[model samples]
Target: MDDSTVDRLAAELYQVSQTGKPVAHLTKRYPDITIDDAYAIQLAGRKLREADGRKGVGAKIGLTSVVMQQLFNVYEPDYGYIMDDMVVMENEPVKMSEHFVPRVEAEIAFLLKKPLEGPGISVADVLRATEGIMPCLEIIDTRYEAGTMKVEDSIADIASIGKVVLGGALTSAKEIDLRYTGLVFEKNGEIISTAAGAAVLGHPAASVAWLANKLASYGVSLRKGDLIISGSLIAACSVEAGDAVRATFDRLGSVSARFK
Candidate 1:
């Protein structure tokens, strides 16, 4: 697709997101759209938000887990930009009505102490650059119709990121083995999912490394102080209004949010 067409599609998707209304699959309408074109649409959408004063804070890695990849029928990971306004505090009330179709997942969030730019970034390099890790809840809201979205559609939709809740605890990467870190996800006081950090691409740090390298392909770099949310450790669960969600990590403590 050409730049004008990409811009128009991006604006359409962004309008759908803002209005909490679902739209038809972009790939179905534009069968010739490539992954690169989808990413360009995503960037164009980000520019739209940036023009409205939303600053990019960091990035989020998606589909790093086999479960999610299988769910999405995709083989590789994808990423999306994180805007500052998308963040919510732990235990804050989230307005569920603001989303079209929102789901929640448990994750480990990394706060960078040094910039990471990679063509050859490794797990060790990610650890060395780390500031700390915190438990987080990623709320994913899709703007596309159900079962109609392809990988390219997801990339264009900014990985369906809606909101993020960061936990209060921040533990150094060297202090614990992230691969072995366990998480118990609870909704309305009952356990709904449980997983280990290794569920995210063998190790949460590995996901960050993957993201750094992936972003490099687009001429982007992970900057210092970026809050990177590694792929979810557990499968995402559907959420509704009046629901209370929580995720307890073995070492990183817990994070919670209430939807209303």
Candidate 2:
């Protein structure tokens, strides 16, 4: 596709997201589309964001759970850049008006102390690149019309990530085996979900590793202090006005958010 074709597709996808329209048949509608070309559309959306002065500060890895992959029929995980504007404090109550459409997820976030770039980075490499990790909640909000979305459409729409909330004490990656770390999610004081670190692509660090090398193909890289939302540890929970949600981790700590 030409540059104009890429931009048109990008704008259409962003509008589809913002309008909450079902974009399932976009490929059929736009015959020039391929996952690679769809990604070109995705980048065009980010370029629009950059044109608006937003700067990417981190990355989010999705499809870490085999269950989610099985449900989606995708063998590989998808990723999206997290701009600085998306990061928020967990202690603060999240205003409902801040989002168009949203859902919350429990995750362990890492702030790298060194750059992570890869064509062949390993889980061990991710652990070594660690500065510290913390508990977090990522808000995945979609703007697709009809509210239905495909994985590629979501990836093109910044993985449907709207905001991320981080808190709890930070711990060194060496302090604990993230694979064995456990967490239980609660909403209004009731346990709603449970997960172990191993659930995320077998280990949370591997998600970051996968992201590093994935972005390397485009010449993008992760830097020190980049806030990576490793992947959801618990099944995502629906949020509505006045609902309170929290996730307590086995070692990392706890983070929470309240709608409205």
Q: For residues 1-260, could you state the per-residue lDDT of candidate 1 as single tens digits?
A: 88999999999998985677788999899888888998999999999999989999999999997776887787889999999999998767999877878999899999999999988999999999999999999999888887667888989999889999999988988979999999999999999998899999999999999989988888889999999999998878999999999999997999999999
lDDT of 1: 0.91
Residue 141 lDDT, candidate 2, scale 0-100: 79
Error of 1 at 221 (Å): 0.7
Structure candidate 2, residue pairs in collision: 17-143, 17-144, 20-143, 20-144, 20-145, 20-146, 21-144, 21-145, 22-145
Model 2 lDDT per residue over 49-153, tens place: 788798988889888898888776788888888887788887677876766667889999988989988889898998898888999999987655553456666
The lDDT leader among the candidates is 1
Residue 73 of model 1, lDDT score = 81
Q: What is the C-alpha RMSD of each candidate to the true structure, in Å?
A: 1.3, 2.4
TM-score of each: 0.96, 0.91
Residue pairs in candidate 1 whose N, alpha carbon or C atoms collide under 3 angstroms:
none
lDDT of each: 0.91, 0.82
